[model samples]
Target: MKHIPVLLDAVKDAIGDMRGLRIADCTFGAGGYSRAFLDAGAHVVAFDRDPHVANDANMFQNKYGNTFRFVPETFSHIGEIDGLFDVIVFDLGISSMQIDVGERGFSFRADAPLDMRMSGKGMTAAELIAKSSVDELATILRDYGDVKKANIIARAAKEKLPQTTFELRDLVFNPNDVAPVFQALRIAVNDEFGEIQRALAAVPNKLACGGRCICVTFHSLEDRIVKNTFRDWTTPPGDARLPETCPAPFKLLKTVTPDDGELENNPRARSAHMRGVIKTC
Candidate 1:
């Protein structure tokens, strides 16, 4: 299946008039957002932990030349990048490419090994399950996936230690749990929440005044992180009635979700939400 970017129009609307601006594409999955920025005459520096995306990055580099650059690392290392940016964008969560290629083990629909490492170098999902205690596994399920039968599934997972996607799916008592179980494991395997926190921490210092930080999040856990962070950025410290001397660093922008047309074409985007904030001096 072709990887259609979720919230492309919404993201574009968030960062209006990209010409001659500097953009940091924090998650260069499938080169979707970066391509859009480059086409609009913005200079883009893209980062992706997955080594598999190097080919797609190369295509962008060849097509965009000096206007584009790719970093072969996770967005958690965004602090290491030099210079400030006019715009920074993150398309969080797994790309369709990761899910489509079943060998990568992101989707349980395909009978692949239970390996959902985004960087292709970390511990596999199977390894995580085997090493985690039942209590630890239950917490991951409850916190990350919000699985209804987290305790029961955790105990079963530890006792059986399934090594493949199908095996893991079978461990779940309810059909509805199959997706959450996979999502919880994927988040744990990638340390996705930690990565987002670290990456967002660097944004204030790296973003130019009047610049924007936009995030398109897929699930509640990730969306909560983005929403809370944006809220903090846009909210004034202390009493709201305090003098106007100390202003909030950023101003909240419009929040967007997939429209009916987008959902009809890409049901995977149904849960996606786009939130953004613009830096205010």
Candidate 2:
């Protein structure tokens, strides 16, 4: 299946006119947002940890010349980029390309090696299962996947670390539980939550004054992080000891979801939630 960016129109609307703006496309999955930003006359520096996207990045460099750059790094290290950007967009989570390929082991639908590394590095999902204690596995399932039967599933998964996706899927008899289980393992293996936290911490400093930060999150775990961080930035600094005159660094813009048309065209977009905020200080 072709990769479709979730909430593309909403993201463009949030950023407004991009002419002469420097934009950071943090996820750079299929170069979808980067392509759009370039088309709008924005100089885009796109980041993607996945090495497989090098070909696409090369194509962009060839076509856009000096207007575009591709960084082979994770968004968590976006702080390394020199200067601030007028706009920063993060489309978080695994890409469609990763999930569609069975060998990547992101989806339970395909029977392949149980590897779910986003950067194609680090410990594989099968290795995580093999090494983690039942308690650790249970915590991962509950926290990342929100799986209700986390304890039971962890115990089952621990009996034998499934070397393949089908083996893991078969361990969980309920059809409904398969997806969440796989998702939980994938997130743990990829350190996705930690990456997001680090990226969020680094974003405010990287955004220029009056700049916008937009995030497209696919799950509640990610959405909550973005929502709370944005809220904290916008909140007035006050306490029993602190002064009310302290200013906020950013102002909340708005949060939106895909419209009916977008949902119909891209069913994968259903879970997407977008949040936008502008730097004030």
Candidate 3:
């Protein structure tokens, strides 16, 4: 299936007139955001850790020439990308390509190796399950997945560490818990929360004065991180228990969600949320 960019129009609106702007497409999943930015005459520096999207990045480079550049790296290291950007957009979580492939182990629909690494490196989901203690697994499920029966699932999963998607799914009897458990495993395997923290911390330094930062998050965990980080950026130091009334560096923008039209066409966008902030200092 073709990967549709979620909240496409809203993202474009947040970036405003992109002509002559330097933008960073932080996730660079399928190059959707980058393509849009390039089409609007912006110079886009796109980053992605997944080697699977290299071809897509190459296509963008060929199509946009000097107007586009791709970096095979994670957004956590976005700070290393010399110079500030007029706008930075991060579409977080697994791309549609990953989930639809079945072999990527992002979805429980097919029996595949329990590999959830976006970069195809690091420990696999199976390894995570095998090594984590019941307490650790419970915490991952509860915090990342918000699964109510986290302890029960963790105990079952620990008895026989699932080597494949189907094996993992079998542990959760309730169909509703399957998705959350899978999500927790994926998040744990990818160290997603840690990466988000790192990326958010580095974002302010990479944004130029009056630059805009836009983030698209699918699940609540990721959305909360984006929301809280933006909140900190918008809050005065005095309110945060600091000595002086140090003003925030960015002004929060309106949050956006998919409309009925977008939702009807793309069911995957149902959980998507988009938030933006503009640098003030």
Candidate 4:
């Protein structure tokens, strides 16, 4: 199945011209954006932390030849790529590819191991929950998921954890309703916010003059950091004292929401948002 790229029109508009452009796709889950850019005649280098994505690179190569390249590495280390580009696009957070894999345990609906690592490394979400105290789980759920049921969920999770995904779901998640607690554990496991902030701050320094970076964020915490980073980058040296609402270095290219058609076709795209910026330098 083709992984639907969220905010396609917005991405194309924000991406602008791509001919002969050197572009970096920071989150290259399904190579949707990378393929799109390459089709537009840009030289696209894409990154995905998941090793599994590399296997899919064969599809891009068979179709697009050298136009698309997938580097299996986290965006945090993507900065090591030399020089700037005409455009850098980041489609942040869990891809449909990962969630689709039943073995990865990203979905609460799926019965699998408790793992949620994007890189397939480190402690699985199951392991974390099993080891965490109620307070720890509560903090993770509240801060990561922005969940109001953190206390209740934590208390419930305390009863059983470090088990399979099914066990965790059975204990804390309401089978009738989706679990925000699961989302929280996934976010925590991935260190999503930290990865985002580091990438956001570093990209400006990596950009060439007038290079653009478009970010597609799915969650509020990631969205907030991107919003603030853009503001800070565009803000004047003395503007730090000003309130948060004031616009600063980069202009608000636009906040793109999914159209009804796209949302209807792919429910996962509902929470997706696109923000684009042009480098002031």
Q: Per-residue alpha-carbon lDDT of model 3 for 152-249, expressed as tens digits?
A: 99999999889999999998989999999999989999999999888888887788889999999999989999898887788764565321222346
Query: Cα lDDT of all candidates, in order?
Result: 0.91, 0.89, 0.89, 0.80
TM-score of each candidate structure, all chains considered together: 0.96, 0.96, 0.96, 0.91
In the range 74-137, model 2's lDDT, one tens digit per residue, is 8888889999999999999988899998898888889899999888888999999999999999
Better of 1 and 4 by lDDT: 1
By lDDT, who's the top model here?
A: 1
Q: Model 4 misses residue 76 by how many Å? A: 0.9
Pairing residues by index, what is the TM-score of model 1? Answer: 0.96
Give per-model CA RMSD. 2.7, 2.4, 1.9, 3.1
Clashes of each: 0, 0, 0, 4
Model 2 bad stretches (over 4 Å) = 238-248
How would you encode candidate 4's per-residue C-alpha lDDT over 1-281 as one tens digit per residue? Answer: 46888887788888777798889989888878887888889988888888888777778878777777777888877678887777888888888878888789988768888898999888888778878899998999888877776788888877765466787777765554246777889889988888887777677666777788899988787789888777667667467643343223555687888989998998988888898888664
TM-score result, candidate 3 = 0.96
Task: Give the range of the ten consecutive residues with the poorest summed lDDT in model 4.
Answer: 241-250
Q: Write the per-residue lDDT of candidate 1 for residues 35-118, one digit (tens) a residue.
A: 999999999999999998999999998999999999999997877889989999999998888999999889989999999999
Candidate 4 ranges with C-alpha deviation above 4 Å:
62-66, 173-178, 241-248
In candidate 4 the C-alpha lDDT for residue 32 amounts to 80
Model 2 poorest 10 in a row by lDDT: 239-248
